[model samples]
Target chain A: MLILHCPYCGVYAEETELHAGGEAHLKRATIGDSDEAFEEYLFMRENKKGVHLERWRHANGCGKWFLCARDTATLEVYGTYPAQTTEPPADIVAAITAKHPGWSWKEKA
Target chain B: MSNAVSALNGQEAKGDVTVRELGLTGMITLRGDFEDENFGAALSQITGAGVPDVRHFVQAGDFTVLWMSPDELLVILPYEKAAETVAAFDAALKGTHFLAVNVSDARALISISGDFANEVLAKLSPVDMSADRFTAGMVRRTRLAQVAAAFWMLPDGSYNLMCFRSVADYAFGLLSTSAKAGKVGAI
Candidate 1:
């Protein structure tokens, strides 16, 4: 079985944990003051096949949040971090909000 | 603020031993800036393991140090060891800004083992339990049947579920139903 390094609980048996998020690093482009730009940001993803950062929860462990990097192709994980330490890149955040008009970070939170 | 649990009222069920399966696991809450030299060393001395960094967990045999928040930790041990552990921890932090509380019996922990355990949990939680995504030795604070609980995946396929003792009775029903339905995985 693949070893999942939970940014929170260390490495654990994969069958008992839960995946909670995708890598939040994609950027959205502004569409010349158009709502389409915002919409694009709200409904897009890379769904890449290589190393991807994601969020996971040890649903049965200590109950904490953590980040993880994995190889979608081989299902091999590279590393992981606590969610607090893994902030979405600023550019990606701006793009996503720009693509989705009225989709400000405050609103998302 | 602490969440406390009272003894269960006089309620009975079929085959229900008079003792409300009200599982009680005492937890000591410790909060401090681990970066502080004294704090780190003191915690390690008491727990026999370094204080876990942000969002991590450190296990010293029966003692589990879970990073509950940025500066908060939950130390869990068997009830019988609570006194000794707390005393050692308290002495180590004689002059620190750390907070240690005796929360023994605050939460009830139940071990749900067997093949269908994951399936039963899936019915009530949205977490992805596929082996690669989430694994054993990990812990997460989440909800079950909309009730708050901490889920711990042990090295074995069993799940250690911890919830406030106040809801012990309610959780028992759900767990029993799931087990009877064979949702707890193969025994």
Candidate 2:
């Protein structure tokens, strides 16, 4: 069972206590955007093999959703942060870069 | 009082860990800004115990208040006092962004007490149930079997668990089966 800390409740919740919210930091492309952008928003995903940023709901725990930075290959969770913000925190990005050099997510490079 | 009978009213117990439905337990889902300066005082006016810290609880006799989230609390009181407590909260937090809802009928509170209580829970719960990790007064929102549940340890090393009313029967079955196996911390 994978254990991830919920940023809101401050508890290390197991997978059974949480629900996966899919890829994180996806920019919502509303009606005004082009068809490609809209399609990307709805279906396109990074699908990275090494590092990944995803959203998870602490469904049974605090009932709050949070973002996780981890390695898809090793299942090594770098960190988890609150989901209120539109982007990952600076420290988390740095930590990921330090562990897995040249790793990037979304538009951050 | 609610017409709901204890969920275990017709059930049989065959395990060392005793499980019984806690009937007619008054519960109020109190939602408010935890950082509000008047929040503690207003809740104290109704529930003798102040709003507990995150994942922590405070008890005043039979009345206890547990913090479920940043803005949520589960207030447990006697069924008779349920009405008065809700009224008090309404009167006190008139202009606040708060919701005091009576949820006594919507959820089932169960008491699992005994030496093997911890072991039975440990079998199904993913959270560390060892005494060193889960001490008294600490509460956790997690799954008991496939349903969402919350439980906290009592001073006497027992447990008070709460689950949705709809899943009470399923929860009881899971607890009983786990207890009957008598496996100590083997998932």
Candidate 3:
């Protein structure tokens, strides 16, 4: 079972106390956008095997939603940050880069 | 006006630990900027207790202030004083961006006391309920069995648990069952 730290309440909650909210930092397509763009926005996902960013809610704890950066294969948590942030914080990016080396969110490592 | 009643009607059970419903506790959900001087001052004045730190609670006189989140607090006091206290909060924080709502009737309070109180709670919650880890003054808002609940240890080593009123009977049943299941002998 995964153990995650909730940034809002500062509690190290286990997987049972949290709910996975899929991918993070998704960009919504505007009304004028093409059908292809809307389809990509709605259905496409990275589903990367390595470091990934996801949203999680402290469902049984503080009831606040937050973002988590972790390795999908190793289950190593890079860091956790508040949900209000549009992208991963500099520190989280730095941590991920240090271990994975030249890794970026959308680009191949 | 109609008469007010507690969810469990003050039911209790005795086993390795004692589980009892603490009827009609006054609770106020306060949300705002904790750093604002006016907010702190008004809360202290109304609840007679200062703001609690992260995952902690503080008691003064008849009130206890629990740190619920980054910008939220749960103030517990005598049931009869809930409305007047909300009014007082409104009066004291006239110009501040804050929310103080009476949640006394919307929730249920239960007490578990005995030498094995920690074990009883440890069965239901995912928290570290050892005496050294979950000592007095700390408050934890987590799941109790399948429901959301918050609990804090009193100075007397007893535990006070709070959950939504609708689930009071379920919470009571879980507590009593846990109490009767025998101690874990670890905590």
Candidate 4:
């Protein structure tokens, strides 16, 4: 079992713990485009052989959104990074400290 | 007055929310890499509770499996067996590639029984608690109010939920509201 590190949830399983959200770099087709254009964008498939990036949900872990890259054939994951990262997004430490003015975050884990 | 009687009478006073006062049971958090055979052996030796090969659980007397993650699991034992199980686990897992944490103080096991238990659970948890999906000897590690939790289905058709004691009151309140809403067609 490959331990996939979720940038937010930390390391998790490669199976049901994470969900494959499909191929990355999917861009919307321009409006007023021909049927052929839409068809090529939607129905067509590259079925790439190697080094493909995708999206995944850490359903069991931290539940944070992130991206992942892997080999389609060998199922060998290359790397994973946060998909939606923000500066102090709902900072758990700061929030807790604010709630408890006397409590020390450094002392508590 | 007895704690259980006070709780039953709905006249019990609240103490530290994180520190359980009443109507809670043993909650031991077992963290280990299941990929290790030695860990499995140590686990079996510890609580006399073997990590079942399946996704759910198979009880061994008083102990019950609560959560079986890829690398960790949470077992819910009776209050009487708490210290013994913890010590046994510590002894077996000593110097091994495993971490047995006694989180009895961290999490609370609330018994949600009676006729409206399922309806109450349906409010916060996404699990389908119908008999077919969730029967006796079944356990599900899911989310409650978007927080991680483990729900164990008992032989009596009741659900023993293991969640952080800090969130127990909030979760219970949510469940109670949902149950009442179900009765009044408020949903």
Clash tally, candidates in order: 35, 0, 0, 0
Flag the better candidate by DockQ, 2 or 4: 2
Which candidate tops lDDT? 3
Question: Each prediction's TM-score against the native?
Answer: 0.57, 0.91, 0.94, 0.56
Comparing 1 with 4 on DockQ, the higher-scoring candidate is 1
For model 1, the superposed segments whose C-alpha errors exceed 4 Å read A1-93, A96-109, B1-24, B53-56, B184-187
lDDT: worst 10-residue window of model 3 chain A: A100-109
lDDT of 4 by residue, A60-105 (tens): 5445557665657777765676665322223433443454455331
lDDT of 4 by residue, B73-184 (tens): 7776776677788788788777877777767667655666656566567666655666576677766665776566667667877666666767767666665555555532
Instruction: Report candidate 3's interface RMSD in Å.
Output: 0.9
List residue ranges in candidate 2 displaced over 4 A: A30-37, A107-109, B1-4, B9-15, B183-187
* Cα lDDT, all candidates: 0.62, 0.84, 0.92, 0.60
Clashing pairs in 3: none
Q: How well is each residue in A51-99 modelled by candidate 2, as lDDT tens digits?
A: 8899999998889889999888989998999998788899899999998
Q: Which CAPRI level is candidate 2?
A: high
As a whole number from 0 to 100, the lDDT of residue A15 in candidate 4 is: 59
Candidate 3 stretches with Cα past 4 Å from truth are: A30-37
Clashing pairs for model 4 are none
- Residue A53 alpha-carbon offset, candidate 1, angstroms: 24
Best candidate, DockQ-wise? 2
Provide fnat values for all models in the order shown.
0.15, 0.85, 0.73, 0.04
| Candidate 3 lDDT over residue span A24-87, tens digit each | 9988999999998898789998888889999999998888999999999999999999999998
